[model samples]
Target: MTQKISPNNYLITVANDRYANSTQLFRAAAMIHEVIHAYYHSVVDDNNSPTTNLSLNNFPALYQAYAQKTYPYGVTVAQHDQMATDYVVSMAMALQEYYYNNNPTPYPFLSYEVFTDLA
Candidate 1:
């Protein structure tokens, strides 16, 4: 969940129970994913206008650029946001997998393949 705690700050929360038994990499990835959401909310959405109407053409240039970058096929603004969020989350998960596999720490209990499959 994402919450606007102040005019200039936002907070993202994940259920504690969800990560209680997860690996450090998994937890970090989850947090990073939420942070990406928060960043999109605060910077892209401007902490307001949760839903955007691209047809109105009132969004920032960055948002329009992103829409063009990912949804050149004429998707709605909401669809663009969803795609961006999925992309960010997937990238975070991939980074987590990379760290889990490359780091010297003995995280034998952590299974990157299982985590990716589950995700």
Candidate 2:
């Protein structure tokens, strides 16, 4: 969840208590999901206005952009849709990089299959 305290500050929270038992990859992905929600909060509702700021006329270049599409579905649905489509690869890449960086080892076949405990 996201809470905006000011123009430039936002509180983005992920439930560690709820997700601590999950795999590292899943926990990492959950963080990316929450961060994207903060992005949505900033881009779509920074001012807390009742009307959407993400329109073709007002924000033409951003209207259909990957992280900025909120047309027929409004802000809520569109944010999730955009995140699901655009950030899945991001989540996987981040998790993969994390595995490689901390372990300092190449993926056996460049796949998570190399991590036995990832299950």
Candidate 3:
């Protein structure tokens, strides 16, 4: 089950496996991905634009939009968010390795610079 937590400002998705049957590390990994998504959303934009709403097609536009915004230091939050997504994708890969016996990984299509890296 995947859910949105408004006050905390992130979404959490749970795999359909029994917790006891799963490796604790993978469970933690899933939580890490959720945390990354929340953090990415919170830091990149102050306004909750519909673009920030999570979807496969809208992710790239959202990332580019945030990356182009002007802030105090001239550093875009989009860069930082992309880094967070990269880290999450790496984590998700490890988790998928454990779950699927090293056969595949998650979000394998997107690059490290794009938030789609973990989408």
Candidate 4:
């Protein structure tokens, strides 16, 4: 379910599992995304009207710009989505890497292509 975090200023919605278990990178990106959203709503939509609100029409354009800004090295909408996905996977990988690094136990893994597609 979704909830309003603030009066038309912010709304909270349930995201996919990726976001829920993301590492610091995803966390950071999520925060940035929200801020950019708010910025667009408050500034672009309001026409600098001084009322704090987001404009639905401006969000997609703002999101595109945000994605480009976040991944300037390889910028694209798909790339941005992949990066966001990677940020989540990195969390799981980091934990597993740490465990395997310390333990002598062998590991079993999945097909792994699922992870590599994040390009």
Best by lDDT: 1
Candidates sorted on lDDT, descending: 1, 2, 3, 4
Q: CA shift at 44, candidate 1, in angstroms?
A: 4.4
- Candidates in order, TM-scores: namely 0.47, 0.57, 0.36, 0.32
Clashes of 3: 0
Location of the lowest summed lDDT over 10 successive residues in candidate 4: 110-119
Candidates 1 and 2, the one with greater lDDT = 1
* Residue-level lDDT tens digits of model 4 in 1-119: 22335434666454678677775434544554454445434443444334536455455466557767886653344444554664546534544454346556575553434323321
> For model 1, which pairs clash?
none
- Candidate 2 residue runs with Cα over 4 Å from true position: 45-74, 104-119
**Number of backbone collisions per candidate, in order?**
0, 0, 0, 1
Q: Once superposed on the true structure, which residue ranges of model 4 sit more than 4 Å away at CA?
A: 1-8, 14-16, 48-119
List model 2 lDDT by residue over 38-75, tens digit each. 87666644434446553344342354463344356565
When 2 and 3 are scored with TM-score, the better candidate is 2
Model 3 — TM-score against the truth? 0.36
Q: Say which candidate scores most in TM-score.
A: 2
**What clash count does candidate 1 reach?**
0
Model 3 is weakest, by summed lDDT over 10 consecutive residues, at 110-119
Task: Give the C-alpha miss distance for residue 107 in model 2, angstroms.
Answer: 7.3
List model 3 lDDT by residue over 3-115, tens digit each: 44663355566756556687555466657655665765564443344655545455545655545664333223543555564675666565545445643556245333332
